[model samples]
Target: MLRVTDQTMTLAAQRALGARQARLAAAQATASSGTRITRPSDDPVGTGEALRVRARLAAGAQYQRNIDDGTAWLNTLDSALGSATGLLRQVRDAAIQGGNGSLNQDGRNALATQIDSLRRDLLATANTQYMGRSVFAGTSDAASAFTDGTPPTFNGTQGGTVQRRIGPDQTVRVDADGGAAFGTGPGSVFAVLDSIAADLRSGADPTSRLTALDAGMSAVAAARSDVGGRLSELARAGQATADAATSLEARRSGIEDMDLGKAVLDLQLQQTAYQAALAVTAKVLQPSLTDFLR
Candidate 1:
């Protein structure tokens, strides 16, 4: 048999009121925070999913940064190669003029001087830098890819590559092969230009030099082609990363963001329920002789 008393009723009402207050507080927190989850305990599985999404977002941000840097490096390299090719074309023109047998000594000397000037310009292009790092240096920390001399020597590394990780499983080479583009040692294009200029000054035909100049131009064109391909690849990767970021952001929002209309309605409902509980408690826990005696 169970007996109902004032003391038991008071205790029961206190517990009921505490429970209502807790529900009200939870609703207020959800409304104020504007999130579906005010605490991890509210939805442990959802918290884990949100955390995983955020981690992926952080990694994607880093990948985006890598893509930007790699693009800059490749663009600079492409521009340098383009300039090198144009200079080679101009030198080829001057070589053709110097090879004209009917042209006199003075004309050859003038053409030789122009070729020499073009050689210096080509050298400068080979040593192109971006953010103080040589694009053709091949991972070498040297200030320039080639040193200035009668036959400029390749100061950059051979076979070494500079690369950037654009994704967890993807990497792109950013630096160029300086030695391949511009032949190293005496076989270099700089030396070839010097030979042409020397032959021009001595009244010898430089038509033979044109073949080697064409080879140099071909090498630069090949390097540029490779760069263009990678740039295109990076462009695709960047777009994909951006799209993934958008989708992931939406997913994260769905997991963490509250629906304002629904949240407000829930909060209002909790407030009304708590008020009703308070009124019911007040009515049931009426002051009695026992409370007065105590």
Candidate 2:
């Protein structure tokens, strides 16, 4: 009976040691990884939640990048439009000077040259390139937005719009068609400029050309207003995107990022428990309880 009791006691001690070792390994792993849920088996529900938040965080980051790229494109376009506006004003001034009847033929010709140069400058602005892509062109990056020098042409296929993700399942188109921004109908701004140049060459009255120049200026102003409206829209959407990204990051932090305070406390608790377990184990594995009792 004494031998049987000793064997039973030894078996119980071994089982207790095995359980303590398993717990110690688990605690060490948790501390080393700094995560309670290293795998699905560790904490299935927590891991699932983390995976979902991680996916959203990834998507939000991509959307932020898209918003940045879209805004950059719009900024380049705004700069080009500003330059074009200045060129138009120069053309208008030259046209006014040409209309002065007091000026001699040589003076009129000089004004005509200025107008032509200004027209070319305007064309260059329209064809402004950003990152090897024409800012005014809808989508085709390889070709210039305007083809004809005397008169501009939209080399792009049709009205194109660029989409930017501003929020969850929300996207906004942030560009206007080149045709609408410039002109399209017969006797359009380009046609009028072409006529102005022809009349100056033929030594005809500059009055009609001057009137057309004023009208073209008005058209340009209208287009600029349109662009300004779109820019405002993009500005609003960009702000919303930024706000959403901030919110998502906050959510991800709440879901995944470890709390240093909680982690530190947990680690200390695990260490204390492990130390206690080791002390008890040493006592149980000792040669004989009588040796200590004595």
Candidate 3:
């Protein structure tokens, strides 16, 4: 005859009940959180991949921010260059009018005054600041790129290029070299304008001033073109970064996120299983004197 002991029955009931409770708890958690792998142990490989993807997403976000800042800096430079070009064109017109020999000393003096004003305006444009930093000042933190002097000396260095990382392996220069755009020392655009103003004030011929004015105009135009190109590059980089971020997020969601409907169904099944196990354990563990009688 086979012997059925209370100890064996109690051990089997405890094991079955413990397993059922554990599964029920897990299902409830999954349903509430709406995630299949709440802990790394649930899916170690997926967790590792999710970590790496999250890191890349964070880096891409930072790159996008850098691109935005670079774009703003380039826009500021473009505006300053446009303003400088307009001033130079006005100076060219004034030079043309002053070159006429029919104009008297008073007429020449009036043109000189207008040129001086325009020169100051151009100087201001060269020292244009964006977000409290000079746009043409390279990496220098100076309030202005040029000093308020006779020739408007360049206080900022051209060797330092303000660059921004827009991608994993890409960086773009956001600042213009003031020395290249406006020249430096006696050959600077400010110096050229000052000299023209002095000549006009002294009743000198305006025909000689046209050459310098044209050269300055050419330099400003080139700088504006460079800024435009960088703005376009930043736009493309921003779009690519955004697309990459979206892809990474989708990949991460696949690994981390869970289906709410499936989780709820699983929870319901686990609850029913747990209740059935409890009822079976209650019946099996009930004392039956038949074993002792045997």
Candidate 4:
């Protein structure tokens, strides 16, 4: 049996008061902060889980940013490809007009001048930039994908598709292959346009020029189709990323957020217990003969 003495009683009351005060402080902190498990010691397992969830949320946000940037890059490519297709169509029309045997030399010269203007426009479209980077340069730091020369040589790297990571293990190509879309060296669309312009100026037969124009048009159309498909895939991936972020945030909230109603109730109960303990301690530790003697 524990011996009952003034020292023992005083010690017991102090311990009781300390425990009640600790409980009250904890409840007050939970209510004020609006979060449970303020410290790792409060709920070690829950804290770990919350930390993991927060990391996942951060990753999801980064993926979302990547998706947005990728979408912009793809959209720019699509617009440029569309413009290229339109320019090719204009060149095809001019080729057909110039093929007419009845057209005079001056008429062919006018058609050649128009085609030259369209060729310059096509070159500009190929060199489209986004945020200071060439869209078709394939990771090259060059300002333009093609040099403006007789046969417009490709200055960008080949087969170096730019990519963006949209998930932990998934990456999506964000740039088009400039070589495949615009050809290289003498086979390039710009070269073909220059050749047609020269033939028109020299009054050469338009049959072969028409054939080359059709082939260039077909290539541009094919590239546009490929970019459209990639846009669709990126849209789907973006939606999935948004859903994942939402789910992750919900999970993190569950682990870290406190229930205000429950916390307030608990705080009131702890306050009452602490007040009661303080009143009882005061009565129990009143000045006695032993304390006075000590």
Maximum-lDDT candidate = 1
Worst 10 residues of 2 by lDDT: 180-189
Please give the distance, in angstroms, between residue 37's alpha carbon in candidate 4 and its true position after superposition: 1.3
Local accuracy of candidate 3 as per-residue lDDT tens digits, 70-170: 99999999989999999999998888888878789899999999999998898889999888988888888887899878777787876998899998899
Task: Give the alpha-carbon lDDT of every model.
Answer: 0.92, 0.68, 0.89, 0.87
Instruction: Give the alpha carbon lDDT tens digit for every residue of 1-294 in model 1.
Output: 899987888888889999999999988888889999877998999999999999999999999999999999999999999999999999998888888787899989999999989999999999999999989989899889999998998989877899899989999999999999998888899988999999999998898998888998899999999999999999999999999999999999999999999999999999998999899899678777886677
Candidate 4 lDDT tens digits, 20-95:
9999999999999999989999999999999999888888889889989998999999999999999988888887
The true-structure Cα RMSD of candidate 4 reads 2.6
lDDT of 1 at 287: 76
Q: Sort by lDDT, best first.
A: 1, 3, 4, 2
- What candidate 2 gets wrong by more than 4 Å, as runs, is 1-11, 21-34, 288-294
Which candidate do you rate higher for TM-score, 2 or 3? 3
- The residue-level lDDT of candidate 1 at 120 comes to 91
Backbone collision count in every prediction? 0, 0, 0, 0
Poorly placed runs, candidate 1 (over 4 Å): 284-294
